[model samples]
Target: MKLSTRIALWAAAVVPVLVVLAGLLLLPLVGRDLRHQQDARLRDRAAAVLPSVRALVAADTRGRPKVEQNQQRKVVDAALDSGVRVTAEDGTVLLSVGPQPADDRAFPTAPGGPATVRDRGAAWRVLTARVSGTGANGGSGTLWVSEPGGLAGDQTAAVRRRVLLVAAVSAPVSALIGFALAERATAPLRRLSRRAAELDPAAPPTPGTGDGPGGGTNGGTEGGTDVGPGGAPFAAVRSGTAEVDELAAALALLLSRYDEQALRTAQALETARSFSSAASHELRTPLMSLRTNLDVLAAHQDLPPAERAEIVAELRDDHTRLLELLTALGTLARGDLVEVDSFGPVDLAELADAAAADARRRHPGAEITVELPPELRVFGWEPGLRIMLVNLLVNAAVHGRGGPLRADPARVTLRLAPAGPVALLTVDDAGPGVPPGERETVFHRFHRRRDSPGSGLGLTLVAQQAALHRGTVRITEPPTGTGCRVEVHLPLPDAGAPTLRLPARRDWITGGQRGDRRP
Candidate 1:
């Protein structure tokens, strides 16, 4: 059921019950009030007839029949509707008037306020007053005045009937008022629902830092507006009502999260496609070479030992190439799909040191030098940064050797330091440098020199890691003037810095160098 309808039904069910309960509480008080008024009336009647009662007692005691009769008439007149009975001090009844029990024995003997006295099946409020005449004809006696007890009961019954009528009438009236108010209150929520329902999740989110959708850097919609498909605004309703405002804010946040997830999902799908395409195209040559070598070994079982050894070496080279290509592609895909939550504080100098140590072990003939600080930390993905450092060192060791006229051992220098808000790292090589015209193209996937023995993805991995960390990478001339230097600048961690915002466009493996641009 709708919220308004539920509220209305609850009001209808509860209001009448509350009214009935209030009536139950008031019933006793009403009855008591009525009884008090009845008692007051009986007291007044007893006072009015007291003098006449005294005269009647005196006349009867003196044996004057005419006087006694006249006083009896006066007593009856004063008593009105209430019952009265007069008794002489000598224990003889002087007069009895209005409603009364046949025997006066049931009357209250004490002279005080009115009290209930029952005779046979009837009840009465009786007040007793002691009267005495003045002067020569002075006499004493008791005067009893009472009204029917049912008077207060009848009044209380009428009040109960009226209360029941009110309770019955309030149910529907209260329900209708409650429904109307509830409907008015929920109008904003209904509008919010309609606007939310109109949103399209597949539409690309407005870029937070670009001129996309919501207009430059305002994050798609300004103020409290959310733009849906076709640029229609899903206005964040902020009625003065706290509940409605809170709900609207929650809805806006939910939509923002949905857009973020949708973008991430699209990126993941693109990465998958690129991974498949690159693997298929790049693995074919090595696989063919491996197959050809295997066929030669199978067909030439009686070939010379030297020739057989050459064939086996060729197969091993092909196998190594295949393995390196696959590993590079997998790492590229991981960088594309990485989330910011995986990033944390990493010591770049430590990673560079480790990479240099591994490079020394692998390329014992190469002369490697490292100039790194004790610690140079940055906020980044540790595995990715380590991969980047490893690739840089390996690339330098493999390609840093000179042409025929150069020295026997290759030379590579790794350095790390801080530059303002960024951590600067450089790898200098003493080999033939890349031409200036080709420096930009060298970072592209599968782009390598023809004579190079390594996978071309080494520099590409370096570039990808740079972009993922919101950093930059560029190739420049080394200080020696005869070789190349690759410089990577990564942002340093700061206590008051805002969270990193990764680039919205990530197409590393899919053939676009957009992600490598210096931000």
Candidate 2:
């Protein structure tokens, strides 16, 4: 149902029930109040006739029955104005007045105190008192007074009837008023809905200058236009209520996010299509060269010994280089698809130590040194961290050419430390430093210096890993002014006394070392 109709129906159903409950709760008190008023009247009448009753008893003690009867008659006469009935002891009827009793119920024996009784059959109220005295004929007697209960009943009935009448009549009337108010309240939301329904996502947004129908761009559109990225526009409709306004704002925010994501998805698809085409084209040349060389070598089984050895060595080296290049390209592609959930906490010190050990083992002639704080930790993906470190170390091993050139030993250093609220990892190599303008370009995929013999994805992987960790990587001259330095700064883990957990194994395809388990 519509909100206004629901509100009206709810008010109609609930208000009458509340009215009836209120009446029910008040009825008993109303009845008691009526009885209290009757009791008060009885008390007053008993007080007035006390003296007359005493006088009648005194005469009876003096043995003058006729005088006593006359006194009783006088007492009854005086009480008649007040609606009283006086009865003597010994079951003698002295005087009876006011409304007659419906039966011989003996006026409900007052016990010389005040009391009230209801006569439902006669629909009357009665109060009685026991008359007492200290004279010879005065042990106990009764005085009774009665009035119609119809007065109180009528008053209560009038109140109840008025309450019910108000409830019945005002229910629909108030409900109609409520419905009108609700309709007014929801009018803005209704307008917003209608305007939103009219929007067309497929249509090109109206141009800036026009005088055509449907508000013709500049004049006034069916709804307000909110500009999004790439100059596209979306409808922005608003409801005036605070809650509805907030909801509209939230919806606008979500729609903008959706537009941004759609654009990103389109861009990613285009980039992927281009990369696939280029990769396929690039791989064919290397494959054909390797196959032709292998076929030529196979066909020359009787060639000179030295020529055969040289050709076999060249083929093996070419095969290795080709495999490395293909592997690097595959790694770069995988990095492009990395998502946020691939990140977690990683220990930089442990990653540096492992990278140092691997570099020493892989290149026995290169000197590797690692300087790391024992507990340097950051929030990052373990595989990405390993990839970054391994690439840095491998680049140093491949390019730091200092052993025979100037009698200075080539050295690679991996250092990690806590820099303020961030973990800083720096890899320095005693090699000819990268040129100032080429520092940033070294991180681009397939962009290699003329002297480097390896696939150019090493620094690209480093940059990608840093980005995935929400960190930054920069290449600069080393502090000693002799070598290239690459530094990565990652945000530090949350501050607390650290808890130790088992470290996870890193992925091999992402440049992580495999098969070294820690228990």
Candidate 3:
């Protein structure tokens, strides 16, 4: 049911009960007040007739019947609506007048105040006063004045009826009022619902799309107005209600998350397609070579030892190239789909040392030198950084051979140091350096020299990871030698550094886009 209707029903149910409870408390007080008023009237009447009662007592004591009868008339006249009874010292009833208890025993000789006396199912409030003559040893008697107890009860009953009538009347009236107020209060919520219903999830609002409602844009969230997240242009109504405003904000946030997830899902699907396409296209040559070599070996069992060794060596190279190609494709896909949550503080100095050590193991004949500080940290994906370091060292090992005029073994230097807010890493290789014109193209996906043994993805991976870490990578001429220097500058982790925000647009696999930092 509607909120307003619920409120109205609750008010209707509760108001009458509250009114009745109030009446229950009020009834006793009202009854007591009526009784007090009656008692006061009885006391007034007793005072008025006291003088006449004294005269009657005196006249009866002197044995004058005529005066006693006249005084009795006066006492009855003064008694008015109340009941009166006069008695002498000897217990002789001088007079009885008006409404009263028929039993004389019911009246107290000297009542402290107004007291109730009952006779034959009837009740009265009685007050007694002393009626005495002026002289000593004079005739003394009690004057009793009373009003009916039922008068207060009747008044109380009338008030009780009125209270019940009020209780019965309040139910519907309170319900109507409550419903009207509730309806008015919920108007903003209803409007919010209507707007939310009109929103199109498939085509959520984007900034600068348009100004119309749900047209994919909001003017701005200036003042207190709020715009929805994830390009949802829902401008919440500023209705001076906290609950409604908060609900609008929460809804906007939810939509934002939905939009983000949808984008990620689309990107994941695209990355998967590119991974399959690239793998098929690149692996075909190596696979064909492997098969041809294997078929030749199977067809010719009596071949020369030299010819068999050459075919076996060709098979090994093809197998290694095929493995490297698959590994590179997988790494690129990972980089494209990586989330910022996977990033953390990674020590570049330590990672570079490890990569250099691994390279030395692989190329025992090559001389590798590393100059790094004790620690150099950057906020980045640890695995990606490790991949980058290994790729850079391996690229140098394979392509960075020593010149014919220099030495037999290749020489490479890996260096790490902090430069301002960034950690600078440089790999110097004593080999034929890349040309100035082709330096930029070397980082593109699957681009390699004819004689290069490694997959072309090595430098590409280096560029991808540098961009991922909010860094830059570029090739330059070595300062002191005729070789290539690949310099990478990655941002350093700091205590007060702002949180890193990943790039929203990534299509490294499908687009074959170079991962260089855009100038």
User: What TM-score would each prediction reach against the true structure?
Assistant: 0.81, 0.66, 0.80
Between prediction 2 and prediction 3, the one with superior lDDT is: 3
Q: Against the true structure, what is every candidate's RMSD?
A: 4.7, 10.4, 5.4
Runs in model 1 lying further than 4 Å from the true structure = 44-86, 90-106, 119-122, 135-137, 199-266, 289-315, 401-409, 432-438, 479-482, 498-506, 515-519
- Candidate 2's C-alpha runs over 4 A off are 49-82, 86-98, 102-123, 128-143, 173-278, 288-322, 336-345, 371-375, 403-411, 417-424, 479-483, 494-519
Model 3 has an lDDT value of: 0.81
Query: Candidate 2 — which pairs collide?
Result: none
Question: What lDDT is reached at residue 391 by model 3?
Answer: 90
Worst 10-residue stretch by lDDT in candidate 1?
Answer: 211-220
How well is each residue in 1-519 modelled by candidate 2, as lDDT tens digits?
A: 999999899888888888888888887788679768766776676677777776665565566789778877777776655556666676666566667465657367646444435554555556666666556555556666666656677888887888798789878987998899989988877776664555555543333332211111221223444433334554655555887676566555554555434433543564466456646655676677778778887898788988878777877776776777777766765654454467667778888898889889988878898888887777767876888889999998777756446345558888888888878888888888788878877776667777677777788778766655546788888889987888888767766834322111112222332111111
Alpha carbon lDDT at 300, candidate 1: 87
State how far residue 192 of model 2 sits from its true place (Å).
11
